[model samples]
Target: MKRYAIIVAGGKGERMSSNLPKQFIQLRGIPLLMHTIKVFYDYDSLIQLIIVLPANQISLWKKLCNEHNFTIPHEIVQGGETRFASVKNGLVAIKEKCIIAVHDGVRPLVNRQTLENCFSTAEHYGTAVPVYAIVDSLRKTENNTNFAVERNQYCIVQTPQVFQSSILKIAYNQTYEERFTDDATVVESLGIELNLVEGNRDNIKVTTPPDLKIAEVLLSEREAIIS
Candidate 1:
């Protein structure tokens, strides 16, 4: 089956308190986004990759790739104001009808097994999302005060969320709405049910400064063990 990945890396990294985009930040001496892309390449070297970068920073990405000696064949899509728009642009760049997986560029630790399962499920199902069951205590809040709810029904969703190319294309063709949190949410509006696959707990998306520190610790620990 033909498979492609759209790595969304357009955010300005304001929360990260860095002048550089968060995805361009280094983790274990590799760009965070590059590490995320490598996971899929490691799983299957042939899987196509399309990186959605901020329009203003596209040249920086190209320069970074050259500086790092990173090489993998992929297309570059300019990011939009919103994540959905960026993904839609990437989807438009794809020429074939196949399974396309949307992954957060900041999430560099998703394992091969999870990806294999997600693709395997997406082949039969029209849509698939990797999710980990919420293990923390249930909480409902109003005005920063906590209430209670059953935690059993909740799961923390992660990427790469896979979907049939045609289905995803149609989903993006719809009118833009702020309600669309993720691609799955947009596609589900078209009457598609999202199939859930088990996710790796370590597959965290680097958002805040603390997340980067955590990723560094994990990567360093892994490297020490390997060495």
Candidate 2:
């Protein structure tokens, strides 16, 4: 079966306090989005990659591609106003039946093992999302109040949310809601249970200056080991 990944990027860099969008920030010498796209290509060179970006940002992305001499093949589609609509637009771009992965553009550190876990699991079980065990204390907040909750009952969800393309397409056909946080949640609105897999601890979403520094260090270490 064919494999496809939809890399959704619509960040405006508000949290990072930068004028540039988070996806275009330099992780090493190149734009971080390039690294995110490369990992999927490294996983399977044959997998089709579809990038969803805002209409205004497409030219900037193209300029970056030329500047860095990046040559990985992928399709670019204009995103919608919200992430849900952006994913919907991405799904529209898929014309064939295959496995589909919805991933974060800022999360450039998802390793091949996790990709293997997600794609294969989704292939067998219909839906898969990566998650890490929460090691911090849990809390629940009510109106003007807060209380402790069971820490063991929760996990931090990450992407590369994989699904059979049919299942995903049907799920995305529903009306959008504020509760639809990620692809997992949007799919779960169909009452389908999500399959969870162990995500790499190092697959951090780069959103702040410190996160960029950390990713640079981690990626440098990996390159050293690989070389």
Candidate 3:
């Protein structure tokens, strides 16, 4: 079956306090986004990879590709103003009916097993979202007051959210809304139940300086194991 990944990376790195977008920032001497793309390719070389980037950053991305001698083939699409719009724009490039995995470009640590599981589950169930069990205490804040809630009732959603291409296309046809935080939410808006798959806690999105440092440590640990 044909496979594709839409890696959304339009953030401006405001949280990272960097001139370059967080995706373009170096992690273990390689661009964070490149590591993300590589993992998908490593899982299935035949999978088509499409990266959604801010309109202004496309040129810089290409330059980085050349500078890094990154030759893995992938398509680049300009992102829209909102993440919902950006994902919709990425969907424009997909033309076949197959498994499509929508992932965060900064989340480069998703393991091979997790990718395979998501795709396999999505292939059978039409939609699958990776989630980690919430271990922290839960709280509800109301009018400056907080109340305890059941942590077991909630899970931390992560990506490589996979779905059948046709299902995803149908979900994206609806008008964009501010409340649509993730692709799963959009699909749920259509009354479709999403399949949940286990995700790794290590699959962190590099959004801040601290996240970068954490990723560096993780990468170093992985390399140590390999060598």
lDDT of 3 by residue, 1-227 (tens): 69999999997889999989999999888799999999999899999999999989999999999999999999999999898998999999998888999999999999988898899999998999999998889899999999999999899999999999889999999999888999999999999999999999999989999999999999889779979
- Model 1 global lDDT (CA atoms, 0 to 1): 0.90
Count: clashes, candidate 2: 0
lDDT of 3: 0.93
Stronger candidate by TM-score (1 vs 2):
2
State the lDDT at 90 in candidate 2.
95
lDDT per residue as tens, model 2, 1-227: 79999999999999999988899998889999999999999999999999999998999999999999999999999999999999999999899999999999999999999999999999999999999999989889999999999988999999999999999999999999999999999999899999999899889999999999999999999899999
RMSD after Cα superposition, model 1: 1.6
TM-score of each: 0.95, 0.98, 0.98
**Candidate 3 segments whose C-alpha is farther than 4 A from its true place:** none
What tens digits encode model 1's per-residue C-alpha lDDT throughout 1-227? 79999999986789999888889988888789888888889888999999999888899999999999989888999989899999999998899889999999999888888999899999898788999988889888899798888888899999999999988999999998998999989998888888999998989989999999998887777668769
* Each model's lDDT: 0.90, 0.95, 0.93
